[model samples]
Target: MESSSALALSQLPYYIYPTIPNTNKNYPFWPAGKRRSSQLPTRLHCNKMFVPGFGEASPEAKAAKNLHNFFTYIAVKIVAAQLESYNPEAYEELMEFVGRHPLNDGDKFCATMFRESSRHKNLALRIMEVRSSYCQNDFEWDNLKSLAFKMVTESNTRLMRDYISETSRAETEK
Candidate 1:
């Protein structure tokens, strides 16, 4: 008298049936005999992750880094300006060298500057080294170099006149 669909439905697994709500006082979801452990496992050590040399530096270290970066920047500007004004061919050669080497950071810039045996490059490197014993800051070497290059190359004589007057005034004051 049972239909085929009814038989098939009855043959399905027990878990397929929806859970019935338990209304008994002694038993909750679990059966009467079984009980889960109440206490959780204790952690033996801290869960915090650490990385070496990735933490903040001391105030003195930070100041030294800033000073180094400042001097490097000034040296780069001075070199570019001098080359642009005094020797156009040497300035072109320097730009070509920079393009080839792609100085991305301070250390790379210093190394490349020294590697090339040019008077301007040597002077610049000497200036930077005398200012700072180490080069750690990953300053924008390419952009700064190009900016200084363009500033001196594109500027009119008026700026130079103003700079001369300012220097003379400072000399008088001193």
Candidate 2:
């Protein structure tokens, strides 16, 4: 695996460009036996891997880890709520069936019919409720608020605005 700089060193057709290595020629400046350059290119790729936006060394890795934790927390909350609110035998049977099959696993779990519905806030809160096991005295919805903000800002802000205008126009026609 040659570095781009190393490959570049091979491309000098004329007297090597001063920026790249060109020891192929028998330059008299070298000792009678020296074959290659003594220096190596410094490796610092800046386009793709960047410092984290919030002062993190590995921004992308941290975001990925946080998202993983958040998703796992939500999944556990969903399962626990389903178990607490339903019959364990039914949930177990459903897990067993899905365990034996290729599937989406969460939405298609069947026994969690209501939890899989369209009420995003309710679903998230219920998951929080299950995970926190608290009643009425603060369920930590704020923990997910930042994630929700990011999802809205990054994923759907423009689409949602356009959809709202489209829906308004369609409603006016009706």
Report lDDT (CA) for all predictions. 0.58, 0.51
Encode model 1's per-residue lDDT on 71-129: one tens digit a residue. Answer: 66665655567779988887786667657764435566677677677764665565575
Task: State each candidate's clash count.
Answer: 0, 0
Relative to the true structure, candidate 2 reaches a TM of: 0.29
TM-score of each: 0.35, 0.29
* Range of the 10 consecutive residues with the lowest summed lDDT in candidate 1: 1-10
TM-score of 1: 0.35
- Backbone clash total, candidate 2: 0
Q: Across residues 57-114, which tens digit of lDDT does each residue of candidate 2 receive?
A: 3665666555544543555546655765676764564355435533344333333534
